[model samples]
Target chain A: EDQVTQSPEALRLQEGESSSLNCSYTVSGLRGLFWYRQDPGKGPEFLFTLYSAGEEKEKERLKATLTKKESFLHITAPKPEDSATYLCAVQAYHSGGGADGLTFGKGTHLIIQP
Target chain B: GAGVSQTPSNKVTEKGKYVELRCDPISGHTALYWYRQSLGQGPEFLIYFQGTGAADDSGLPNDRFFAVRPEGSVSTLKIQRTERGDSAVYLCASSLDSNNEQFFGPGTRLTVL
Candidate 1:
């Protein structure tokens, strides 16, 4: 079975603190890994997509790195505005094209205190 | 261009009632998806549509749930005989293609009384 797990369910950090969130997965065929940031009452915003091991992507204060069995979202000097639930999902390639749906992780709730 | 948009930001319906939520994907997007998220939980995939055809409906929980994207643009999710367990936020997303990054809508918060 394909499963995605995210550790540190909840994290509280002071403004300007640096931290990392983890996402581990077990899938038949890993096609792509995605990261999203969701604010209260709003939909998730796309952050990054990592397709292969040893790949990394960055935006602003966030950086995403991928490995064979897991991925990491590293936050550098995170501000209060960076506080949100970070979601991780994996796409498993099926017979036709790619997998239709994404298997999502439980998400890591991040709170940045100013 | 504008991002994905959903209608009825919030809806409160009684148990056993039927409800429909709407989604307007970004213009020119070829792939649309539906997901359900309970409080404090991750969004669970419900369905995906490629153009006017449903590419995959395997994630749908049961026959009570149905979705359509007749014109390959806007989509709607219908739930029959709603139960308390059905109360959650329904999210809609769209992408240029199945493998591309998805742009999500604000989502509809449904409450069953």
Candidate 2:
């Protein structure tokens, strides 16, 4: 069965602190891995998509790296505004089965205390 | 341009009733999706539509949950015999063609009493 597990269920970081969140997965065929940031009462905003192992993507103060068994979302000098639930999702490559929706992890609740 | 949009924003319904939540995908998007998220958990996939056809509906928990996309641009998720457990945020998202990143809507918070 394809499953995604995100560790460190909750993290409290002081402003300007650097930290990383983890997403480990077991999938039949790895298609793509996605990261999203969701704020309270708002929809998740797309962060990055990594398609292959050793691939990495960055946006502003956030960087995402992927591996064969796991992925990491590294935050650099995060500010209070950067506090939000970071979500990780995986999409399996199901050939001839049409489009597949994402299998999401429980998400990591991040808090940046100022 | 506007992102994905969902109607009502909030819905309060009683148990055993029927409710419909709507979603309007981004313009020209060929893929639309529905997800249900309970408090403190990640969003769970409910259905996926490619154009006007349902390519994946296996994520739907039960037969009481149904979704339709007649024109391929707009979709609706209907729940029959609603239960208290059905209370959650119904999120709608769309992608260029399912191989791209999805843009999500603010979602509709459904409350079952």
For this target, which candidate reaches the highest DockQ against the unseen true structure?
Answer: 2
TM (chain A) per model: 0.96, 0.96
Q: Model 1, range A12-102, lDDT digits (tens) per residue?
A: 9999989999999998888899999999999999999999999999999999999999999999999999989999999888667766588
Candidate 2 residue pairs in clash (backbone atoms < 3 Å): none
The per-residue C-alpha lDDT of model 2 at residue B31 equals 92
Instruction: Report the lDDT tens digits of candidate 1 across residue range B48-101.
Output: 999999999988999999999999999999999999999999999999989888
**Candidate 2 residue runs with Cα over 4 Å from true position:** A95-97
Q: Across all candidates, what is each one's fraction of true contacts kept?
A: 0.83, 0.87
User: Whole-model Cα lDDT per candidate?
Assistant: 0.94, 0.94
Candidate 2, B7: how far from true, in Å? 0.6
